[model samples]
Target: MMNLISNAFLVVRPLEKRNKLIDEYNLIIEGLRSKGINIIELTSKEHLLSTKYLCSGHWISSLGKGVVVVYPMSSLGRQQERNDLVFDLLGRKGFKINDVVDFTEAENEGFFLEGTGSIVLDRLNCVAYVSVSKCSDEELFVEFCEELEFTPVIFRSSYSDGLEVLHTSRILTVTESFSIVASCMVKDKKERKMLSLQLKKSGRDLIYISEQQVENYVTDIKQVKNDKGDSFVVMSKSIFDSLYTDQKNTLGKHGEFLVFDCREIERQGKHSIGSILNDIFS
Candidate 1:
């Protein structure tokens, strides 16, 4: 499976030293490597101030196969996050580079579409579930779908704290046979129904999570399979603890839970266990 990730690039907070954060990031990177995933690091040197922009890394890689489509980043800092070095590195590793779509200028001018974060891709079904937010631009989203030949389903979702849902991945995850979505985050009943129906039609059993659990980031979990094909759900210990007994059981039925403490990284508000890891395929 091809996973997506950006390099550990961030604008250090004005008063905070970045060295420690870099170290923590390296540790997270190491954890991902141990799992046998290929890492694709974006080395762009531009600097932008939005977490949403880092998601462009998702576009730089193929979702499940080796097809590449690059997205433009709206944040100036993020434009700097892309690195030719990273692309060269991936190319050398055997990941085919099919096409590169540059949307950087449009994004810089205000057009936005925050890669995987804004759109939760059901690769097996060729569907992209998106929540319209500041980071998710409808026109650009449709354009992306058209470019990639993906079917786009757009809706509005919000976090318990009333923050516009920045990333679809933060509220929904799809495995081979099941999907976990924080239904509370999705405000529109009709849209939710459409999303659920799409998943059902695609052969994915639906699992719903609550808003409170999502607040703790429990919904931002990643499902991975080891060499033996044994599945495991990787998440932070905080998220694991936030799950109810039933939710835990539901996930356990699909895979073993692998939880790591991320209190330090969480403080930065920039790192997610998923983003920290590199995609093995480049």
Candidate 2:
């Protein structure tokens, strides 16, 4: 599989405190386009409800080819944010609607899986790792794995006080050459080892991050490509600052990178690069 995405899908929905984010949003879009990456902006609906961060487009993910999987979201705001417009736009863009695994109905059963935010997909290796939380349902995860033919690794990740992390990307991130993970995310020693072994078996070098870094949103990143075919990981200045010099060197060995000055965005939306952008076609 060609894992590099040449085109990106970004949503324009603002958070409840969005008056200050318009500039940040435009700069991010301009930066991505400047790198020769195609940008598809999804316009927000007319709903006036206060959505804290529905702009992430977390209710669906493109499963390569024309296949798109609509997920079950915990937030009613996000569920409502998954409008039909994205699908219509994709259809017009010639993305074949091969099949859609509509897990949206699972919300009635109290099971929620918020697309890529609740799970990290190693598409090339066909492996998915989900940190069990209110937003990530194990049964639905199993169903997703079966439909996509992936090995599912489900585990619990929490903070020092036992509050579970809401998003899998907060602690576990998969890049093309390495996996940046928080060992503490897997509370059980044996389970952590098993997860690490699985990644090693799948051929990814491991880079362990500290709990402090995870708390600062360092894992919230994504691997992207430039027009010249060079690979780079997009991150925030906070993510870059949270890392040690040596850790940065090791991560740089995998790919070049771009860091955005997004302190205000993080303060307003509590999200970084990976959270704001989604890829529709590459």
Best by lDDT: 2
Worst lDDT run of 10 residues, candidate 2, spans 48-57
User: RMSD per prediction, one decimal?
Assistant: 4.4, 2.2
Flag clash pairs in model 2: none
- Cα lDDT tens digits, model 2, 1-282, are 635453556556454346567667777777877887656766776663534354444787886776788888786766777777877877777677788879888999899998888888887878899988899988889999998888899888888888898888888888777788897767888888887888778677778888888877888767777667777778888989888988788778766777887776688667777777776753
In candidate 1, what are the lDDT values of residues 126-200, reduced to their tens digit? 788888877778888888889777899888888667778876777887666568888667878898888777877
The lDDT per prediction is 0.63, 0.76
TM-scores, all candidates, are 0.81, 0.92
Q: C-alpha displacement of 268 in model 1, angstroms?
A: 0.3
The TM-score leader among the candidates is 2
Roughly what TM-score does model 2 have, to 2 decimal places?
0.92
